[model samples]
Each structure stands twice: as structure tokens, then as C-alpha cells.
Target: MTESDHRAKLFGTDGIRGIANMEPMTVETCVRLGRSAAHVFKDGTHRHRILIGKDTRLSGYMLENALVAGICSMGVDVLLVGPLPTPGIAYVTRSLRADAGIVISASHNSYQDNGIKFFSRDGFKLGDDTEHEIEQLTFTGRIDDIRPTASEVGKATRIDDAGARYIEHVKRSFPNGMTLEGMKIVVDCAHGAAYKVGPWVFKELGAQTINIGVEPNGRNINVGVGSLHPEVAA
Candidate 1:
């Protein structure tokens, strides 16, 4: 049987994941997923928008591009927030009233691994039924013929303020009168999505922050200094 003939479940309780550029995580699969998701979520008279974010991984670039391509093909505009934590993407999606949100990361996985997860407009993971529909559309190629054309085709734009917005949201969680002042903290970002915003949040809260895993060369993520490698931070 072909990959599709005997296709098993694609999305898990979280989302689709595997070794980057490998069978389940290949660019092709992401494209199919994007288009399928757009097909499922687009609604109303106004143009639809989706938020996409990624962690620091070399394969992130490839998958992000593929997802953008697939989403836009369905006439749904895309907001690209490069290199933000998964939660950051969800916050942006809810704040901006997006149709959905996509996150590109493998969480605690090594740099060679990657995954895609989606959040709804309400900043929560999509339900099983919706995820199943997206999978069906992808595997069945039902969205191929329905692709949009011309100006109606969705566009992808970078959200320059995405990181800032997430940072502010996090800061709001702290008590209004309280601050992290005088507190010395070490934050390990895993050199992944949270590298920038993680330390910045603490610093903005008035903490003296020692940020590690903040410099991701794409390959160093989850290496020896992130939440996965806590000792490295010490």
C-alpha cells in the first residue's frame, strides 16, 4: 500500500511530529497539513488569518515555508511570527482573532527533530474532531481542487510585534505591585523558541537574569543547556 493507501493517524493528541525532513515530518506533509487546516477553519465574509511560529531549528525554516505555502493556497492569510515559544503563538492567535495558530517545534526534542501543533482562536489546542478532519482533507487531497486563485489567495506577512506582545502578556501574570527586583535567576531557554522572550520576560519583571541557551545557532537547541539539560545551566 502507498503512504496514503494505508495511512494511519497523522495527528496525535498534540500534533504531528517526527524527525525533521523525515517521513512524517517532511515538507510535503506540512504543506498538506496547512492546506487541510485552512480548509477546515476558514469562515465568514472577511479574509481569514492564521498565526504561525517556530523554534530555533534549521528545519524550522523549511517547514515554516511549506506551511505558509499551503495555508496561503487556500486563500487564508498567514501571520508569520518567527522564533517564538509555542505559547507565544497561541496568545497572538487569540489576541489577533486569528482563525488558528501553528507552532513549529519538537518541544524537548533534539535539533534534528521537529513537529507541528495547532491552537484554536481561543488559545487552546484544536479538538480531536477538528484535527481528524484536517487529517482527512490532507490525506484525501480534497482541498487540492478547491485552492483559491489570484488576489483571493492568502498572503503571508511577518508580525514584527509578535514577540513584544507575548512578553507583555507574560509580564501581566506577575502581581501589579510585585517585581523580580533583587532576585538573581538563571533561565534556560533550551536554545529553542523561548530563547529571546524567556529571559526578556524575567528582565522586564525586574529580575537580574542570567539567561542561558539564549543563543541558538539552530543546531544547539536542547543540546546541553536547556530545560532538558538542566545541569548545563548550573
Candidate 2:
């Protein structure tokens, strides 16, 4: 049986997830996923792009580079927003008008786990049908023959301002005249995606924030801190 046949489903409700560096999350699978997604999102001769964002998982570095290699190999430019929230990636994807967005995260799961999710140009998570298409393409090898060379190959660019942009975007959601000047908030980032933004957003809005779980050593994410352990901040 093929990889797909052996595994009943490659993508769960939240995308492909597993122990980091293991079967589904392995670099080889990530490359295949990148190539398949690139093929599915291609839209004519116009240069296409995909935005990638991730949380503070050490495995993220390994997976991110693999995805970039695969996507770029298939001629899709990549916009990397290093270490941002999942939603921030979606917003940045639309903010930059990329063809699609990808998030490398496993939400509240422990650091040992990781996941991959996609978003459309509109900044919405991809639907089941589109995800299914990408999955099928990944295992079927139908996209292997379609490769771009020279200038046609895709390039990867880093979006240095992605965090600032997301900060501004989220700040807009608060009441126009509202400020957290008198509010004392305890912000526990769980050392995940929101580590930097969580405290900064509140502090900038004038809140006195007592921050815990802000120091992400990559492997410490969601370990005895963050949302999983609210008492840490409480």
C-alpha cells in the first residue's frame, strides 16, 4: 500500500499533525505537501506566492525549510513570517496578497507535536475539498513531473514587519477610543505563537501586564505554562 493507502487520513480536522520529525511531520512529507499545495494554488502565469508562519517549536525550523524547498522547487514564491500566531499568518497572507498561507503549529499540544494548516487568499482556512485535493496530489506523485527551473523557480522572502503589522491589525479591533490604561492583565503566552505579541499588545494598549511563559526556549512551549496552566499567571 502507498503512504496514503496505509494511512487512512493524512490531514485531521486541523491539518496534518503528528510527533515532530515522525512520519507525517517528517521533512520528506513536508516537501511533498509544499509541492502539492503549490500546484493546487497555482493560477496561471502570474507569479504565485504562499505565506508561512509558525510558533516557537524547534521542529518548526526543520519543517519550514522543507516546505520552502518544496514550494520553491515548484515555482511558488514564499513569504515567511517567522514565529507568529496562526491567525497572524492568515492576516499577513491577505495583507500581502499571497495566493495562500500556511501555519506550522499544533495549538495547545505539547512541544513534541507539530501540525501544518493552510489558508486561502481571503485569509480563511482551506475547506475540506481543497485540502483533500492537496492531500491526493501529495501522495499520488502527479505533480512530480511539473517542475520549474531558472527564473521560473520560486523564491523565499522574509517579512520582517509581519509582527508589527499584526499588532496594528489587532489593535484596530479594540474600541476606537478605548485604552487599557487602568487594567492589570496577566499575560501567559504558553511560549507558543503569541509569546511576543500577547504581552506587547496589552502593554502597548496601556495595560499593566504581568507576563509569564514569554520566554520560549522552543522546547518549553506549553510546558507547565501558557493556557494549559493558567495558574502560572493567576
Best TM-score goes to which candidate?
Answer: 2
TM-score of each: 0.96, 0.97
Q: What shift in Å separates residue 46 of candidate 2 from its native position after superposition?
A: 1.3
- lDDT of model 1 at position 30: 84
- The reply for model 2, stretches above 4 Å from the true place, is none
lDDT of 2 at 175: 96
Residue 119 error, candidate 2, Å = 0.5
Candidate 2 on 134-226: residue-level lDDT in tens?
Answer: 988888868889988999999999989999999999999999899999999988888888988889899899999998888899899999987
Q: In candidate 1, which residue pairs get closer than 3 Å at backbone N, Cα or C atoms, i.e. clash?
A: none
Candidate 1 C-alpha lDDT tens digits along 137-194: 8889566798678899999999899999999999998889998899999998878888
Q: Over all chains combined, what TM-score does candidate 1 have?
A: 0.96
Q: Can you give the lDDT of residue 227 in candidate 1?
A: 64
